[model samples]
Target: MKALKPRRFGWWYVAEWRLRGMRSYRWTILLMTLGNPVLYLAAMGIGLGALVRVDVAGVSYLHFVAPALLVSTTVAEGFNEASWPVMSGFRWQKFYLGMSATPLAPVQLAMGESVAVSLRLWVQSFTFWLIGLAFGAFDGLVSILIVPIAVGAAMATHAVVMAYVATIDNDVVMTFMYRMIMMPMFLFAGTFYPLETMPVFLQWIGWISPMWHGSQLARVVAIGLPEPGWLIACHVGFLAVWTIGGLLWARRTFTKRVVV
Candidate 1:
Protein backbone atom coordinates (compact mmCIF):
# COMPACT_ATOMS: atom_id res chain seq x y z
CA MET A 1 0.00 0.00 0.00
CA LYS A 2 1.15 3.53 -0.74
CA ALA A 3 2.00 5.69 2.27
CA LEU A 4 -0.64 8.24 3.17
CA LYS A 5 0.28 11.83 2.31
CA PRO A 6 0.39 14.20 5.23
CA ARG A 7 -2.44 16.73 5.28
CA ARG A 8 -1.02 20.25 5.05
CA PHE A 9 -2.69 23.59 5.59
CA GLY A 10 -2.96 25.70 2.44
CA TRP A 11 -3.21 29.26 3.73
CA TRP A 12 -1.97 30.79 0.49
CA TYR A 13 -4.96 29.20 -1.19
CA VAL A 14 -7.18 31.20 1.14
CA ALA A 15 -5.31 34.36 0.19
CA GLU A 16 -5.89 33.55 -3.46
CA TRP A 17 -9.61 33.24 -2.80
CA ARG A 18 -9.65 36.65 -1.16
CA LEU A 19 -7.72 38.10 -4.07
CA ARG A 20 -10.24 36.65 -6.48
CA GLY A 21 -13.08 38.25 -4.55
CA MET A 22 -11.24 41.54 -4.75
CA ARG A 23 -11.21 41.21 -8.51
CA SER A 24 -14.86 42.21 -8.62
CA TYR A 25 -13.86 45.60 -7.27
CA ARG A 26 -10.80 46.07 -9.42
CA TRP A 27 -12.02 49.38 -10.80
CA THR A 28 -12.45 50.83 -7.35
CA ILE A 29 -9.01 49.68 -6.38
CA LEU A 30 -7.52 51.03 -9.56
CA LEU A 31 -9.10 54.44 -9.08
CA MET A 32 -8.02 54.64 -5.48
CA THR A 33 -4.47 53.38 -6.02
CA LEU A 34 -3.99 55.66 -9.00
CA GLY A 35 -6.23 58.66 -8.34
CA ASN A 36 -5.87 59.36 -4.62
CA PRO A 37 -2.21 60.36 -4.65
CA VAL A 38 -2.63 62.62 -7.64
CA LEU A 39 -5.69 64.34 -6.21
CA TYR A 40 -4.14 64.87 -2.78
CA LEU A 41 -0.71 65.79 -4.06
CA ALA A 42 -2.17 68.30 -6.47
CA ALA A 43 -4.60 69.74 -3.96
CA MET A 44 -2.60 69.89 -0.77
CA GLY A 45 0.93 69.45 -2.03
CA ILE A 46 0.54 71.98 -4.81
CA GLY A 47 -2.49 74.11 -4.03
CA LEU A 48 -1.95 74.53 -0.32
CA GLY A 49 1.76 74.53 -0.94
CA ALA A 50 1.35 77.61 -3.08
CA LEU A 51 -0.16 79.69 -0.28
CA VAL A 52 2.53 78.79 2.25
CA ARG A 53 4.99 81.10 0.46
CA VAL A 54 7.84 79.73 2.57
CA ASP A 55 9.88 76.62 2.57
CA VAL A 56 9.20 74.01 5.29
CA ALA A 57 12.22 72.39 6.87
CA GLY A 58 14.49 73.68 4.07
CA VAL A 59 12.56 71.87 1.33
CA SER A 60 9.63 72.73 -0.87
CA TYR A 61 6.27 72.40 0.89
CA LEU A 62 5.31 69.70 -1.60
CA HIS A 63 8.35 67.63 -0.63
CA PHE A 64 7.65 67.87 3.08
CA VAL A 65 3.99 66.91 2.64
CA ALA A 66 4.44 64.21 0.01
CA PRO A 67 6.03 61.63 2.28
CA ALA A 68 3.52 62.36 5.02
CA LEU A 69 0.66 61.80 2.57
CA LEU A 70 2.33 58.60 1.44
CA VAL A 71 2.46 57.38 5.02
CA SER A 72 -1.14 58.46 5.63
CA THR A 73 -2.45 56.77 2.49
CA THR A 74 -0.62 53.56 3.30
CA VAL A 75 -1.92 53.48 6.89
CA ALA A 76 -5.46 54.34 5.80
CA GLU A 77 -5.38 51.63 3.17
CA GLY A 78 -4.06 49.17 5.72
CA PHE A 79 -6.79 49.96 8.23
CA ASN A 80 -9.43 49.71 5.51
CA GLU A 81 -8.19 46.30 4.48
CA ALA A 82 -8.63 45.01 8.01
CA SER A 83 -11.97 46.58 8.77
CA TRP A 84 -15.10 45.78 6.71
CA PRO A 85 -13.62 42.69 5.10
CA VAL A 86 -12.85 41.26 8.50
CA MET A 87 -16.37 41.94 9.70
CA SER A 88 -17.81 40.33 6.58
CA GLY A 89 -15.75 37.23 7.13
CA PHE A 90 -16.90 36.81 10.72
CA ARG A 91 -20.37 38.33 10.83
CA TRP A 92 -21.93 38.30 7.37
CA GLN A 93 -20.14 35.91 5.07
CA LYS A 94 -19.00 33.41 7.70
CA PHE A 95 -16.22 32.48 5.32
CA TYR A 96 -13.74 32.07 8.13
CA LEU A 97 -15.99 29.58 9.89
CA GLY A 98 -16.35 27.66 6.66
CA MET A 99 -12.62 27.59 6.21
CA SER A 100 -12.20 26.22 9.72
CA ALA A 101 -14.18 23.14 8.63
CA THR A 102 -11.25 22.20 6.41
CA PRO A 103 -7.64 21.56 7.39
CA LEU A 104 -7.19 25.32 7.40
CA ALA A 105 -6.70 26.50 10.96
CA PRO A 106 -7.86 29.85 12.34
CA VAL A 107 -4.31 31.15 12.59
CA GLN A 108 -3.76 30.20 9.00
CA LEU A 109 -6.87 32.05 7.97
CA ALA A 110 -5.76 35.12 9.90
CA MET A 111 -2.36 35.08 8.27
CA GLY A 112 -3.88 34.50 4.86
CA GLU A 113 -6.15 37.50 5.25
CA SER A 114 -3.28 39.65 6.44
CA VAL A 115 -1.06 38.64 3.54
CA ALA A 116 -3.73 39.34 0.94
CA VAL A 117 -4.32 42.80 2.36
CA SER A 118 -0.62 43.47 2.62
CA LEU A 119 -0.27 42.67 -1.07
CA ARG A 120 -2.97 45.21 -1.86
CA LEU A 121 -1.18 47.78 0.28
CA TRP A 122 2.06 47.10 -1.54
CA VAL A 123 0.44 47.86 -4.88
CA GLN A 124 -1.18 51.00 -3.53
CA SER A 125 2.08 52.21 -2.02
CA PHE A 126 3.90 51.63 -5.29
CA THR A 127 1.34 53.71 -7.13
CA PHE A 128 1.56 56.49 -4.54
CA TRP A 129 5.37 56.50 -4.77
CA LEU A 130 5.38 56.69 -8.56
CA ILE A 131 2.97 59.61 -8.49
CA GLY A 132 5.20 61.40 -6.02
CA LEU A 133 8.22 60.83 -8.20
CA ALA A 134 6.43 62.10 -11.27
CA PHE A 135 5.48 65.27 -9.47
CA GLY A 136 9.11 65.75 -8.39
CA ALA A 137 8.04 65.63 -4.76
CA PHE A 138 10.85 63.23 -3.97
CA ASP A 139 14.49 64.25 -4.35
CA GLY A 140 16.25 61.20 -5.79
CA LEU A 141 16.66 57.46 -5.71
CA VAL A 142 17.07 57.60 -1.93
CA SER A 143 13.41 58.56 -1.67
CA ILE A 144 12.62 55.18 -3.18
CA LEU A 145 13.79 53.64 0.07
CA ILE A 146 10.91 55.27 1.98
CA VAL A 147 8.43 53.04 0.13
CA PRO A 148 9.12 49.93 2.25
CA ILE A 149 9.37 51.95 5.45
CA ALA A 150 5.92 53.39 4.80
CA VAL A 151 4.52 49.94 3.98
CA GLY A 152 6.01 48.47 7.16
CA ALA A 153 4.34 51.16 9.23
CA ALA A 154 1.09 50.52 7.40
CA MET A 155 1.35 46.81 8.11
CA ALA A 156 1.86 47.58 11.77
CA THR A 157 -1.36 49.55 11.76
CA HIS A 158 -3.09 46.82 9.75
CA ALA A 159 -2.18 44.16 12.30
CA VAL A 160 -3.55 46.18 15.19
CA VAL A 161 -6.78 46.92 13.38
CA MET A 162 -7.20 43.26 12.47
CA ALA A 163 -6.81 42.27 16.10
CA TYR A 164 -9.46 44.76 17.08
CA VAL A 165 -11.82 43.63 14.34
CA ALA A 166 -11.51 40.04 15.52
CA THR A 167 -13.09 40.95 18.87
CA ILE A 168 -15.83 43.23 17.63
CA ASP A 169 -19.46 42.09 17.34
CA ASN A 170 -20.69 45.02 15.29
CA ASP A 171 -19.54 47.67 12.85
CA VAL A 172 -20.25 50.51 15.28
CA VAL A 173 -16.84 50.30 16.92
CA MET A 174 -15.19 50.27 13.52
CA THR A 175 -17.01 53.47 12.67
CA PHE A 176 -15.72 55.07 15.82
CA MET A 177 -12.22 53.91 15.01
CA TYR A 178 -12.35 55.60 11.65
CA ARG A 179 -13.98 58.82 12.81
CA MET A 180 -12.40 59.25 16.22
CA ILE A 181 -9.11 57.39 16.04
CA MET A 182 -8.09 57.45 12.38
CA MET A 183 -9.28 60.94 11.57
CA PRO A 184 -7.63 62.51 14.59
CA MET A 185 -4.32 60.80 13.87
CA PHE A 186 -4.49 61.82 10.24
CA LEU A 187 -5.16 65.43 11.14
CA PHE A 188 -2.74 65.76 14.04
CA ALA A 189 0.05 63.30 13.40
CA GLY A 190 2.60 65.73 12.01
CA THR A 191 1.35 65.10 8.49
CA PHE A 192 1.02 68.77 7.61
CA TYR A 193 3.55 70.32 9.99
CA PRO A 194 6.25 69.48 12.47
CA LEU A 195 4.98 68.15 15.79
CA GLU A 196 6.92 70.83 17.62
CA THR A 197 4.81 73.47 15.94
CA MET A 198 1.70 72.10 17.61
CA PRO A 199 0.74 73.08 21.14
CA VAL A 200 2.86 71.26 23.71
CA PHE A 201 -0.08 69.33 25.15
CA LEU A 202 -1.24 68.17 21.71
CA GLN A 203 2.23 67.19 20.59
CA TRP A 204 2.03 64.04 22.68
CA ILE A 205 -0.68 62.73 20.34
CA GLY A 206 1.82 62.55 17.52
CA TRP A 207 4.42 60.93 19.77
CA ILE A 208 2.26 57.85 20.22
CA SER A 209 0.72 57.78 16.75
CA PRO A 210 2.04 55.16 14.28
CA MET A 211 1.31 57.58 11.44
CA TRP A 212 3.64 60.11 13.05
CA HIS A 213 6.38 57.57 13.53
CA GLY A 214 6.07 56.37 9.95
CA SER A 215 5.98 59.92 8.63
CA GLN A 216 9.07 60.78 10.65
CA LEU A 217 10.88 57.81 9.15
CA ALA A 218 9.74 58.75 5.65
CA ARG A 219 10.85 62.33 6.13
CA VAL A 220 14.23 61.13 7.34
CA VAL A 221 14.71 58.98 4.26
CA ALA A 222 13.06 61.20 1.65
CA ILE A 223 14.44 64.60 2.67
CA GLY A 224 17.19 63.77 5.15
CA LEU A 225 15.28 65.45 7.95
CA PRO A 226 17.51 65.76 11.00
CA GLU A 227 16.72 63.07 13.54
CA PRO A 228 18.78 61.61 16.33
CA GLY A 229 19.99 58.09 15.63
CA TRP A 230 18.43 56.87 18.86
CA LEU A 231 15.07 58.38 17.93
CA ILE A 232 15.18 56.61 14.59
CA ALA A 233 15.84 53.33 16.36
CA CYS A 234 12.85 53.91 18.65
CA HIS A 235 10.63 54.58 15.63
CA VAL A 236 11.63 51.34 13.95
CA GLY A 237 11.39 49.39 17.21
CA PHE A 238 7.95 50.71 18.05
CA LEU A 239 6.53 49.74 14.66
CA ALA A 240 8.12 46.31 14.84
CA VAL A 241 6.70 45.55 18.28
CA TRP A 242 3.20 46.65 17.26
CA THR A 243 3.31 44.60 14.07
CA ILE A 244 4.42 41.43 15.86
CA GLY A 245 2.25 41.87 18.93
CA GLY A 246 -0.88 42.70 16.97
CA LEU A 247 -0.47 39.74 14.62
CA LEU A 248 0.02 37.39 17.54
CA TRP A 249 -3.08 38.73 19.24
CA ALA A 250 -5.02 38.42 15.99
CA ARG A 251 -3.92 34.83 15.52
CA ARG A 252 -4.97 33.93 19.07
CA THR A 253 -8.28 35.69 18.77
CA PHE A 254 -8.98 34.12 15.44
CA THR A 255 -8.15 30.67 16.79
CA LYS A 256 -10.44 31.13 19.75
CA ARG A 257 -13.30 32.31 17.59
CA VAL A 258 -13.05 29.71 14.86
CA VAL A 259 -11.78 26.65 16.69
CA VAL A 260 -14.20 26.88 19.60
Candidate 2:
Protein backbone atom coordinates (compact mmCIF):
# COMPACT_ATOMS: atom_id res chain seq x y z
CA MET A 1 0.00 0.00 0.00
CA LYS A 2 1.17 3.52 -0.74
CA ALA A 3 2.38 5.55 2.22
CA LEU A 4 -0.38 7.55 3.80
CA LYS A 5 0.07 11.27 3.35
CA PRO A 6 0.15 13.53 6.35
CA ARG A 7 -2.83 15.79 6.60
CA ARG A 8 -2.10 19.43 6.06
CA PHE A 9 -3.62 22.16 8.21
CA GLY A 10 -5.89 24.01 5.79
CA TRP A 11 -6.52 27.41 7.36
CA TRP A 12 -5.66 29.98 4.70
CA TYR A 13 -9.07 29.79 3.10
CA VAL A 14 -10.62 30.33 6.47
CA ALA A 15 -8.37 33.32 6.98
CA GLU A 16 -9.34 34.73 3.58
CA TRP A 17 -13.05 34.60 4.27
CA ARG A 18 -12.67 36.13 7.73
CA LEU A 19 -10.53 38.89 6.28
CA ARG A 20 -12.95 39.50 3.44
CA GLY A 21 -15.83 39.86 5.85
CA MET A 22 -13.81 42.31 7.91
CA ARG A 23 -13.25 44.77 5.04
CA SER A 24 -16.61 46.43 5.43
CA TYR A 25 -15.87 47.10 9.05
CA ARG A 26 -12.20 47.94 8.48
CA TRP A 27 -12.73 51.66 8.99
CA THR A 28 -14.60 51.09 12.19
CA ILE A 29 -11.92 48.71 13.37
CA LEU A 30 -9.23 51.21 12.48
CA LEU A 31 -10.91 53.99 14.34
CA MET A 32 -11.62 51.93 17.41
CA THR A 33 -8.12 50.48 17.42
CA LEU A 34 -6.44 53.83 16.92
CA GLY A 35 -8.81 56.16 18.68
CA ASN A 36 -9.46 54.33 21.95
CA PRO A 37 -5.79 54.31 22.87
CA VAL A 38 -5.66 58.02 22.28
CA LEU A 39 -8.25 58.30 24.95
CA TYR A 40 -6.35 55.79 27.07
CA LEU A 41 -3.23 57.86 26.79
CA ALA A 42 -5.06 61.05 27.47
CA ALA A 43 -6.85 59.57 30.43
CA MET A 44 -4.23 57.27 31.91
CA GLY A 45 -0.84 58.11 30.52
CA ILE A 46 -1.32 61.85 31.03
CA GLY A 47 -4.01 61.97 33.60
CA LEU A 48 -2.98 59.13 35.83
CA GLY A 49 0.72 59.31 35.17
CA ALA A 50 0.58 62.90 36.33
CA LEU A 51 -0.73 61.80 39.70
CA VAL A 52 2.10 59.31 40.18
CA ARG A 53 5.70 59.78 39.12
CA VAL A 54 8.12 58.19 41.54
CA ASP A 55 9.14 55.53 38.95
CA VAL A 56 8.13 51.98 39.72
CA ALA A 57 10.85 50.15 37.77
CA GLY A 58 13.11 53.15 37.20
CA VAL A 59 10.78 54.29 34.44
CA SER A 60 8.20 57.05 34.38
CA TYR A 61 4.63 56.10 35.18
CA LEU A 62 3.55 56.46 31.58
CA HIS A 63 6.47 54.38 30.37
CA PHE A 64 5.81 51.76 33.01
CA VAL A 65 2.15 51.34 32.10
CA ALA A 66 2.78 51.20 28.35
CA PRO A 67 4.40 47.76 28.36
CA ALA A 68 1.83 46.34 30.73
CA LEU A 69 -0.97 47.67 28.57
CA LEU A 70 0.66 46.15 25.51
CA VAL A 71 0.56 42.61 26.83
CA SER A 72 -2.76 42.93 28.69
CA THR A 73 -4.56 44.39 25.72
CA THR A 74 -3.01 41.82 23.40
CA VAL A 75 -4.33 38.98 25.53
CA ALA A 76 -7.65 40.77 25.98
CA GLU A 77 -8.12 41.23 22.24
CA GLY A 78 -7.00 37.68 21.50
CA PHE A 79 -9.51 36.34 24.00
CA ASN A 80 -12.15 38.53 22.36
CA GLU A 81 -11.50 36.85 19.04
CA ALA A 82 -11.57 33.48 20.74
CA SER A 83 -14.68 34.22 22.78
CA TRP A 84 -17.45 36.44 21.43
CA PRO A 85 -16.54 36.38 17.75
CA VAL A 86 -16.02 32.65 17.74
CA MET A 87 -19.22 32.20 19.70
CA SER A 88 -21.02 34.34 17.18
CA GLY A 89 -19.80 32.10 14.40
CA PHE A 90 -21.03 28.97 16.11
CA ARG A 91 -24.27 30.31 17.53
CA TRP A 92 -25.71 33.61 16.38
CA GLN A 93 -24.23 33.44 12.89
CA LYS A 94 -24.24 29.63 12.59
CA PHE A 95 -21.30 30.14 10.24
CA TYR A 96 -19.34 27.15 11.48
CA LEU A 97 -22.03 24.63 10.60
CA GLY A 98 -22.31 26.17 7.16
CA MET A 99 -18.55 25.93 6.68
CA SER A 100 -18.59 22.39 8.01
CA ALA A 101 -20.97 21.56 5.17
CA THR A 102 -18.16 22.51 2.80
CA PRO A 103 -14.50 21.37 2.53
CA LEU A 104 -13.47 23.85 5.19
CA ALA A 105 -12.62 22.13 8.44
CA PRO A 106 -13.39 23.25 12.00
CA VAL A 107 -9.73 23.55 12.92
CA GLN A 108 -9.22 25.79 9.91
CA LEU A 109 -11.99 28.06 11.04
CA ALA A 110 -10.62 28.28 14.57
CA MET A 111 -7.05 28.76 13.40
CA GLY A 112 -8.16 31.42 10.96
CA GLU A 113 -9.91 33.28 13.74
CA SER A 114 -6.80 33.00 15.91
CA VAL A 115 -4.69 34.44 13.11
CA ALA A 116 -7.20 37.20 12.57
CA VAL A 117 -7.15 37.81 16.28
CA SER A 118 -3.38 38.12 16.16
CA LEU A 119 -3.80 40.77 13.52
CA ARG A 120 -6.24 42.56 15.75
CA LEU A 121 -3.83 42.39 18.68
CA TRP A 122 -1.05 43.67 16.49
CA VAL A 123 -3.18 46.61 15.44
CA GLN A 124 -4.04 47.46 19.01
CA SER A 125 -0.51 47.06 20.43
CA PHE A 126 1.16 48.97 17.63
CA THR A 127 -1.33 51.77 17.95
CA PHE A 128 -0.74 51.87 21.69
CA TRP A 129 3.03 51.90 21.24
CA LEU A 130 2.93 54.66 18.65
CA ILE A 131 0.64 56.75 20.74
CA GLY A 132 2.75 56.04 23.79
CA LEU A 133 5.76 57.30 21.86
CA ALA A 134 4.03 60.56 20.98
CA PHE A 135 3.39 60.98 24.66
CA GLY A 136 7.11 60.17 25.32
CA ALA A 137 6.51 56.80 26.87
CA PHE A 138 8.29 54.54 24.30
CA ASP A 139 11.77 55.68 25.52
CA GLY A 140 13.78 55.02 22.32
CA LEU A 141 14.44 52.97 19.14
CA VAL A 142 15.41 49.95 21.22
CA SER A 143 11.88 50.01 22.52
CA ILE A 144 10.62 49.81 18.95
CA LEU A 145 12.41 46.49 18.38
CA ILE A 146 10.20 44.96 21.03
CA VAL A 147 7.11 45.49 18.90
CA PRO A 148 7.46 42.12 17.17
CA ILE A 149 8.32 40.44 20.45
CA ALA A 150 5.24 41.94 22.04
CA VAL A 151 3.26 40.57 19.12
CA GLY A 152 4.71 37.11 19.64
CA ALA A 153 3.94 37.25 23.33
CA ALA A 154 0.44 38.40 22.49
CA MET A 155 0.00 35.59 19.96
CA ALA A 156 1.22 33.07 22.49
CA THR A 157 -1.28 34.45 24.99
CA HIS A 158 -4.00 34.03 22.38
CA ALA A 159 -2.91 30.46 21.88
CA VAL A 160 -3.68 29.13 25.35
CA VAL A 161 -6.84 31.18 25.83
CA MET A 162 -8.15 30.34 22.37
CA ALA A 163 -7.39 26.68 22.87
CA TYR A 164 -9.43 26.69 26.04
CA VAL A 165 -12.19 28.56 24.26
CA ALA A 166 -12.31 25.95 21.48
CA THR A 167 -12.67 23.14 24.00
CA ILE A 168 -15.90 24.64 25.31
CA ASP A 169 -19.26 23.19 24.22
CA ASN A 170 -21.03 26.35 25.28
CA ASP A 171 -20.24 29.96 26.24
CA VAL A 172 -21.18 30.08 29.92
CA VAL A 173 -18.05 28.42 31.30
CA MET A 174 -15.75 30.58 29.23
CA THR A 175 -17.46 33.73 30.44
CA PHE A 176 -16.70 32.73 34.00
CA MET A 177 -13.11 31.93 33.06
CA TYR A 178 -12.64 35.43 31.68
CA ARG A 179 -13.92 37.09 34.81
CA MET A 180 -12.31 34.84 37.39
CA ILE A 181 -9.05 34.10 35.58
CA MET A 182 -8.22 36.64 32.87
CA MET A 183 -9.36 39.81 34.57
CA PRO A 184 -7.25 39.18 37.64
CA MET A 185 -4.22 38.33 35.55
CA PHE A 186 -4.54 41.61 33.65
CA LEU A 187 -4.66 43.69 36.82
CA PHE A 188 -1.76 42.17 38.72
CA ALA A 189 0.56 41.26 35.89
CA GLY A 190 2.87 44.22 36.47
CA THR A 191 0.71 46.69 34.58
CA PHE A 192 0.84 49.56 37.03
CA TYR A 193 3.83 48.58 39.15
CA PRO A 194 6.85 46.33 39.19
CA LEU A 195 6.29 42.75 40.29
CA GLU A 196 8.94 43.22 42.98
CA THR A 197 6.75 45.30 45.22
CA MET A 198 3.93 42.76 45.42
CA PRO A 199 3.52 40.27 48.24
CA VAL A 200 5.60 37.13 47.77
CA PHE A 201 2.50 35.03 47.12
CA LEU A 202 0.95 37.42 44.68
CA GLN A 203 4.17 37.63 42.69
CA TRP A 204 3.46 34.08 41.56
CA ILE A 205 0.67 35.39 39.40
CA GLY A 206 2.97 37.66 37.46
CA TRP A 207 5.58 34.93 37.22
CA ILE A 208 3.27 32.62 35.33
CA SER A 209 1.34 35.23 33.43
CA PRO A 210 2.25 35.35 29.72
CA MET A 211 1.62 39.07 29.76
CA TRP A 212 4.19 39.52 32.52
CA HIS A 213 6.73 37.47 30.61
CA GLY A 214 6.05 39.56 27.55
CA SER A 215 6.05 42.73 29.60
CA GLN A 216 9.50 42.01 31.04
CA LEU A 217 10.89 41.25 27.61
CA ALA A 218 9.24 44.37 26.25
CA ARG A 219 10.78 46.56 28.95
CA VAL A 220 14.19 45.20 28.12
CA VAL A 221 13.83 45.97 24.43
CA ALA A 222 11.78 49.14 24.72
CA ILE A 223 13.78 50.86 27.41
CA GLY A 224 17.35 49.91 26.47
CA LEU A 225 17.89 47.92 29.61
CA PRO A 226 19.79 44.68 30.10
CA GLU A 227 18.09 41.55 31.30
CA PRO A 228 19.35 38.06 32.16
CA GLY A 229 19.79 36.42 28.77
CA TRP A 230 18.58 33.06 30.06
CA LEU A 231 15.52 34.57 31.68
CA ILE A 232 14.65 36.35 28.48
CA ALA A 233 15.19 33.14 26.51
CA CYS A 234 13.05 31.16 28.90
CA HIS A 235 10.16 33.61 28.83
CA VAL A 236 10.11 33.93 25.04
CA GLY A 237 10.62 30.21 24.52
CA PHE A 238 7.83 29.27 26.92
CA LEU A 239 5.47 31.65 25.20
CA ALA A 240 6.41 30.17 21.82
CA VAL A 241 5.74 26.65 23.01
CA TRP A 242 2.34 27.68 24.27
CA THR A 243 1.53 29.38 20.99
CA ILE A 244 2.53 26.50 18.68
CA GLY A 245 1.10 23.85 20.95
CA GLY A 246 -2.07 25.84 21.42
CA LEU A 247 -2.50 26.15 17.66
CA LEU A 248 -2.16 22.40 17.17
CA TRP A 249 -4.51 21.45 20.00
CA ALA A 250 -7.11 24.05 19.09
CA ARG A 251 -7.10 22.98 15.45
CA ARG A 252 -7.51 19.31 16.29
CA THR A 253 -10.28 19.92 18.79
CA PHE A 254 -12.08 22.33 16.52
CA THR A 255 -11.89 19.83 13.64
CA LYS A 256 -13.45 17.18 15.88
CA ARG A 257 -16.14 19.55 17.17
CA VAL A 258 -17.15 20.66 13.69
CA VAL A 259 -17.84 17.08 12.63
CA VAL A 260 -20.08 16.44 15.63
Candidate 1 runs further than 4 Å off: 1-9
Query: What's the CA RMSD for each of the models?
Result: 2.1, 3.3
Range of the 10 consecutive residues with the lowest summed lDDT in candidate 2: 1-10
Q: List model 2 lDDT by residue over 58-163, tens digit each.
A: 7777777776666666666666666766666766787888888866667677777776666766777788778778878777766776567777877777777666
Error of 1 at 227 (Å): 0.6
Residue-level lDDT of model 1, residues 134-208, one tens digit each, is 998988888987788888988999888988898899888989999998998999999999989999999888888
Best by lDDT: 1
Clashing pairs in 2: 143-222
Q: What would the C-alpha RMSD of candidate 1 be, to one decimal place? A: 2.1
Q: Which residue runs of candidate 2 sit more than 4 Å off their true CA positions?
A: 1-9, 24-28
